[model samples]
Target: MDADVWTERVARDYDTSSTHMYAPEVLGPAVDFLERRAGQGPALEFAVGTGRVALPLSERGIRVAGIEKSEPMARELCGKPGGEDVPVTVGDMTTARVTGAFSLVYLVYNAITCLLTQDEQVACFGNAAQHLAPGGRFVIEVFVPDLQRLPPGETARPFHIGEQHVGFDTYDLVNQHLVSHHYTVEAGRGTTFLSPHRYVWPSELDLMAKLAGLDLIERWADWNEAPFTSASRSHISVWRKPPSRTGTL
Candidate 1:
């Protein structure tokens, strides 16, 4: 599917289908982590779709701000309960000016992969770094791709499972990207959706952090501080900016 079309359709159903599905469960721990690390002064959320995390964080008096590229998504956010009060700029996260040097800047829910290019991903790191005060941190949540799920030399992984059972499984692995097809059958009807995603190794993100002049501070398999080991499937990685060399001058 075309990117624009996918984005447009996603903007409409994002809140109802996905945002509401996972926000509270994810955002609760995420906010707590940021507050503990950065003292909850000010924060910038990249791709603050439908105020899923932003609204809850703002309610904690964190002085949160957000950047969003999709106008429809922004509009949908503005219409939510308590959402009108949150300050969000409608622009690409990599190019938008966040105004203040934030104590914590974050991108969650694997939204960074939406950029779909190494250059864009690198620019995202630079932009996040630029928004940080000295010693500030950037936090990201993403899943590490599992090569074991893919068949050799094939970009497609066909898979099917549901809340009840597994019907089939297939994965498409292509040049650092993964797409999954999960098919569901119910009442003599079958449905399928292609969920496209880019999966980067954790080490690659650390390198991105280094190139952007930030250093990895901590990594967790989950928000609850589960040890990041080979057994883990997802990660919450934190990187901190080094203090300026001229501070003593």
Candidate 2:
């Protein structure tokens, strides 16, 4: 991901634009799932953003740390209440290393797609594994590629249409590339932001986990533990690092 993309303006306005995601119905279940799997203490979040999940999770008494590529975003997170308690490393999630290990390492809200390439995505999994203790779990929540929903020869689709904001995604099917275009009207002014992503299949992610020496343990349609099916538009997946047999990682 380009750190430049998340400027101070973007960081400042992020929470407001994504207010719906912070709703109790959406955030509560996600935090509950992570807290349950977060074993004794610490958890690491990738692309922690404006401390959305990390803050609440920490409030729940879990020790939360984060790796964020954007200084502006990290600044926004650090400025929040109780945000100071959670340490954040400013660097690439695919290569940055935080001190010590964690019982859980997670990348939520489709952050993995930000890597843009299969190799980078796989490396991100490896980095998560690097931060995990033996027997620890690595989790991710991401949208499933909806190519099936795309009309033949159609390159773009609208994902959100609202009075305050509108969003659409354009696809480059051959390269597995997608760019989400968002336009929002605020205070009688209009602004736009475009975010690029690399869409990956569920099976492809499983293979990435295997390459990272992690084992898939569970897959759910949502944080509510609903069964994931072919019709599911998104998924939450958990992969476990093998327990050390020789007292070595």
Candidate 3:
């Protein structure tokens, strides 16, 4: 499914189903990291769904804006407390343009993979760079593709299994694509959701950032600034637009 369709379908349950992402243990470090990078200027989120991180970041006195492809998801954010204060542009992250340059631009929770093509992903990096002021930072939080977990012939792997929810990823090795499948159960009823994504390697993403005129500054295994090793399941990467470029040219 495309971003709009899948996002609208899952917006209602997004917060609840992804409860672990919002827990203070998981969210605190992310907000802390972004707030430090924000440096008294505004920060922009590429997919600010339901104000999960944006709300708290704003609470810390940083101005926050967002670019969201799904109106339903934007509405979900708007309905929450402090949500109206954040201006959201309802459009694709690859091409959306908000009013002012931001000191920090972020895309979290593997949202970068939602762009199902290499070109789109590259364009997203360019877009992020376009929104950043000189020396501004862009942060991305995404999972490292774990093909090792899949046996020779297996195309799918279970990532989460709980009493109320089950989640897995199905891979298309040839296309470098994956579809995350989620099934949430409530009172004996189950609902399934599929979100399509294009998995990108770290090297490929670095090239994309370079093409967008961004330079890699740091990469970590998590929000806590842990070292990124081969065994790490995911990464939090930061890139900076050079101080020379003042605007999108």
The numbered model that scores best in TM-score is 2
Q: Compared with the true structure, what per-residue lDDT tens digits does model 2 show for residues 46-115? A: 9999999999999999999999999999999999999999999999999999999999999998999998
Best by lDDT: 2
Worst 10 residues of 3 by lDDT: 1-10
* lDDT by candidate, in order shown: 0.74, 0.93, 0.90
TM-score of each: 0.82, 0.96, 0.95
Alpha-carbon runs more than 4 Å astray in model 1: 1-8, 19-25, 151-174, 180-195, 244-249
Q: Model 2 misses residue 143 by how many Å?
A: 0.5
- For all the candidates, what are their Cα RMSDs to the real structure? 4.1, 1.6, 2.3
Cα miss at 231, model 1 (Å)? 1.1
For residues 48-163, write the lDDT of model 1, one tens digit per residue: 88887788778877888889887777887888887877778988887788788988889887777767677778888999999998888899998767676555775444332345
Lowest summed lDDT window (length 10), candidate 2: 240-249
Tens digits of lDDT, candidate 3, 51-166: 89999999999999998888889999999999988888988999989999899999999999999899999999999999999999999999999898899999999888888888
Selected candidate, larger TM-score, 1 vs 2? 2
lDDT of 1 at 202: 90
